[model samples]
Target: MELTQRIKQRLREVEDWNVVRDELETEAASHADKSEQSRALYDLARACESVFLDKAHAMTCYQQAFKCDQSNLTALRHAREIYQEMAHLEMVARLMGLELARNTDASIQPSLSYDFGMAMLNQRKIDEAKSHLEAAQSLEPSNERYSDRFQEVLYDRGKWQLGLENVMVQLRALTGSDDPLGSDVVKRGHPLSALFLRAARILQQESPDDPKLLPCLFKSLDADPSNDEAGYLAETILGNGGHLQHVQKLQDRRIANTDAPEAKLALMLAAANVWHVRLNKPEMADYFYHQALDLAFNEAIVDVGWGSDWFLAAYRRLAQGADESGNADSLVPLAERGMSMLGEVDCSILALSAGELAWKKFKDVDTARRFFSRAAKLAPDHPQVVAFRRAEGLDDEAKTTKLPAMAPEAEVLTRELPVADDDDAVDVRVDETPRRSTFVDPASAAEPEPTRTPEVDAEPEASPEPEPEPEPEPEPEPELDVEVE
Candidate 1:
């Protein structure tokens, strides 16, 4: 059943392929030995491929050859090549899995594992694909294909949906003139956009001064325009890098263009800072700040950092403006909003400012006291609180929000005590408090009313001048002598 090299070489002639294929098939069927039958069938499959150009028949022959003799995994490889040429990845994986299960060859396992991983990935078996891909990379660390594909899988495998979308993006990019993408993709969690974001961050970390950083960041946002973090990052970079004009254009294009709350909230904060901090256009800043804050307060968006630094900064500016203008009607709501997000501000100062605004702007003394109390509670020992409390009394339930721990004696008085008789009540209360002696200053004492020292009596009082006391004689001479001794 074995075909010699001479016959195989002759079989390469296309004109005689049908004759040779028929002869090989006859020989394979005649073999009683399975190994002999496998060899003859392999020759027949090759004739079918190279001679007849019949891939389907070639694949059938290859599979039959492998089944006849498991020792010839070459048959499976030939079948796999056909499946791969047809782009039938499921079949390729199935064939490869079978070959690896049966073959113990170490030299080819890495390539096999790699191919299998790719097939699994296309099949949407993410975690399994990762393992196989990782194994291939581990086995052959020098192979960049193995390692790079493995990393690509790592980038998105944490979420299967994202990984699947990422793969789809990759596939689509190859299938047409360009990638299938748009503004709405970010709202749907576009994975290509996420990958671009990671690349931009790496570029920023590795080469902060590189000119490519801005473009990379822009590309990420372009891939997913509604990405809040990417939008804010680009805004910050553009703003701080003296590209304020470009930043304005970027915000103008992104802000009102998308209905995404996160996009608007984050971008608005950035816009506010541009107007408020860089340009000193408070009127414009006020609009953007209110836009961001309204969304933030209404819980329409999550933390876009409003940026990492901008969220807190925006509120601070608003509060400062309110205090400086001396006319903000929403001062109470501002304080409440600021205090609610405690970590975003120097809360004691914010509360203190609100209290000042309430008192100075609107003469809202009670509201001022309420905020002052909160300020004191947040920072019990703030110098401003101390000075205010010392200079002016805020006496009421709202005077103090919190106090230091009571001293031991004071603590004892605060505890409830059993009632006692009226006589014992006085004693019990007095015993708990320290006794004190009262003193009166002569200057402060009321003088007795001048009675009828009438007109006639005033003249008679001149005789009383004899009441002046005589000077006492000195006994100092005797005392001095004893001291000297």
Candidate 2:
């Protein structure tokens, strides 16, 4: 192409710049003012620089252009863009600060605020980040992207050290966070039920009705089916073993899915608990108990507080079962293993329960008392231990008062009479005179005239003859008549 034609084409491409420049030049020449021409030249320069990808150069030109002509919208827009590109965020922030001060466009300020928030985020100024981000979000509520970013910042803030409420707030801001297996869901605390459910979901993918998942849910349900966290637990149990077997089929169809370690653990626990505590299937219980213990072993470091308890319980049960069946050798190692997992606090409770069980069921009072005493020492204020002590006292009292067995006749006599007076009652002598037993017709009886009865009455001879008595009443009547006269 010829040079002239190329120039023409270039000129045509920037027609707005040329036209504006020409008009400004004409006006300046007419007015004989160098300032207008200079300003026009600056505007032309800014227009040419707008094509440059170098944001810095474009920004400088735009600022110069605007100084020359304050009403330059192109310069204003280009300057804003360059301010946005300035990698020295502090400087970019200052420029935004200037824009905010001007308050030129209410709509643009919110966006500017959002950009500042992002800049703050890049600098890791969290408080400032949240402040600016929230301001931006408030102004432009329709911009979910900004809201999401703000919530993401909050989520990161609560990774470990922050309180659970803080973490949950951020989680709720994200959709579907209520579902454990949902993409944005984060487990902030020891929400065992949710954790179990998440594992179950993962397991479900492996085998729709994996028997593995059933036991996990069943144990939780049995322990407390009404627990909100255990909602899916029930479903998983049904899937694995309950009527429909729908989950099983789903799992069978997708058997290639991987088993989640957590889910497997949960399932094992559920199964073992049900088999041991519910169904009393020792073999089944042992199989899952060991599996659960193994899983707990892996999780101990991450979830030590509760995981340790679970592991210890499973190991203890398994060992006890083995020991009771004459497999003391196998039981020894398990007991040792569980003991290792036991923390001081938990050990106290376990010891106490063990002692009580031994005593109450087996009448090993000495052992039980030792256990109760240890438990009291472990938790002096524990209500249960205190109650146990009260019960122990009552039991002792009961034993002390236990009476000896008496002869059949004595037993019958003692039982027949309601105790009228405990102290007043006399113990019948072995060889006492025989007393005649008497009874009265309760309905037709009248009080007997107070009188002495003969010790022996043979046939009452004829109607009792009136007892002969001397009459001496006449003298007393004569003396009373004389006194009245």
TM-scores, one per candidate: 0.33, 0.27
The 10 consecutive residues of candidate 2 with the worst lDDT sum are: 476-485
Tens-digit lDDT string for candidate 2 (273-322): 44433232455456455545444433332132222234433444544454
Task: Judging by TM-score against the true structure, name the best candidate.
Answer: 1
Off by over 4 Å in 2: 1-46, 49-56, 69-77, 155-485
Sequence-dependent TM-score of model 2: 0.27
lDDT of 1 by residue, 294-357 (tens): 5554442335643222333345455556533222555467446534434312344456656656
Judged by lDDT, which candidate is best? Answer: 1
What are the clashing pairs of model 1?
none
Q: How close is candidate 1 to the true structure, as a TM-score?
A: 0.33
